[model samples]
Target: MIFLLGLALLRGRVGDREAWHCGAVLIHPRYVLTAGHCVRDPNIPNLSLLGVRLGELNLTTNPDCQLGLCSSVVDVGVEQILVHPEYNRACLACHDLALVRLSRAIENLLPQIYPICLPLDPEGELGGSTDALHNSRDWGWIAGWGSVSGDPFNAQLPTVLQKAQVPLTPTPFCDALQQRYPDPSSTLCAGGEGPFTCKGDSGGPLMIDNRMRTRWYVLGITSKGPRVCGAPNTQTLFTNVHHHLSWILSNLRP
Candidate 1:
């Protein structure tokens, strides 16, 4: 599960105790790709970021191991932040994407905290390629630490990692929603009923396995879903990472 958590807060107010809320990961060696809203409203002075505990699926345990099995770890702080230049809070379109630059490399601490590969062709829309994705059914994985239910606006961070299944809908079905939202060119849609992303799930991964190899690949970053959480027949929108590959590489590389 190559997942990252993110949030925004008045920068200086965060204490050492609030590690989980401040965490993010490097989508590139130098750049941190997270939800655009994560770093919104930079008017506050004290901005901070923390690194997640990799390989540790459960985050509920105490860091000191006093309560339960705790993992010995050192969380790193972010040095700089860069939300997408095009981000707009009003429409919630292309600006939903963001990036952060860390002070140092976290590779040694948790190698598994590596970047998920972007698709070879981002705009190659998944709808037309039914033959390739068909055998796998409409199933896909959505991982995050969002609230279990209720409170559509507020979200609960998971003590333990959480994951759910999301089914793929036809392009025609997605097009209808896209018309209403007019999302970024890099957007993708998934979900129907039963399984969907909630409030805290934003900026997480929607993973799908290769039909032939069964290898897991991240399809997109979990974005919005029906405005309110867990609405029936509502689909989640994600920024198609593949579509922004060049932009990401250029910005994050140097």
Candidate 2:
């Protein structure tokens, strides 16, 4: 996997056993944006919350693919977790997004642990309509250290760098699916059946890794999928980063 500058990846475990599930990244030095579902736990208090680790990409060289035995974490009190105010995990559409701000600014970190550049308004619209991303058969990259497959415990944690080719689903088709499934604000869909992004990969970035100047600017965050991983009708849903650009920037500013 190719590593780039100013891309801070987030990783944490389920329970306390260290099964690294997914990642989020810094959109600004003070705020970290990830999938709302990633931080969801009905019973836990914010005080008992875990800290976020920054930096550390080892896909191509690290044999075990582990971030390291121990990682640096800040006791980020949830302060406020803006879970897409509209998000209903059951409905799974408009509210799949969320933002978390640290109680204080993080200090003394290298550029690798810096924030990612978010696209400005209309920038995300530069590509065509949602239908294009869904049906065109164009290919983009999804990054995460999640399991390559879903055999549960069969796969190890801090998974190897794996990627798959996915075709965009037509917006009309997605709209119909949304009507039936009922996520009206749905924007784009990709991946069907095997070789798609999965459980431990929520909130990860969907990017064009071919560029030389900028690392994949995030277009979407892994939002939803079928009950079973990669089912034919089951496609991965993402929050169109472009649509929420203004909301993101307003919050980022102090």
Top TM-score model: 1
Tens-digit per-residue lDDT, 92-123, candidate 1: 45546666665666454333345554555422
Global Cα RMSD, each model? 5.5, 5.2
Candidate 1: count of backbone clashes, pairs at least 3 residues apart or interchain: 6
Ten consecutive residues with minimal summed lDDT in candidate 1?
4-13
**Looking at model 2, which ten-residue stretch has the lowest summed lDDT?**
62-71
Q: How well does model 2 score by local distance difference test?
A: 0.56
Q: Top model by lDDT, which number?
A: 2
lDDT of 1 at 173: 51
Cα lDDT of all candidates, in order?
Answer: 0.55, 0.56
TM-score of each: 0.71, 0.70
Candidate 2, superposed: residue stretches over 4 Å from native? 5-19, 41-48, 59-80, 89-93, 103-111, 121-137, 152-156, 159-165, 171-177, 180-183, 209-215
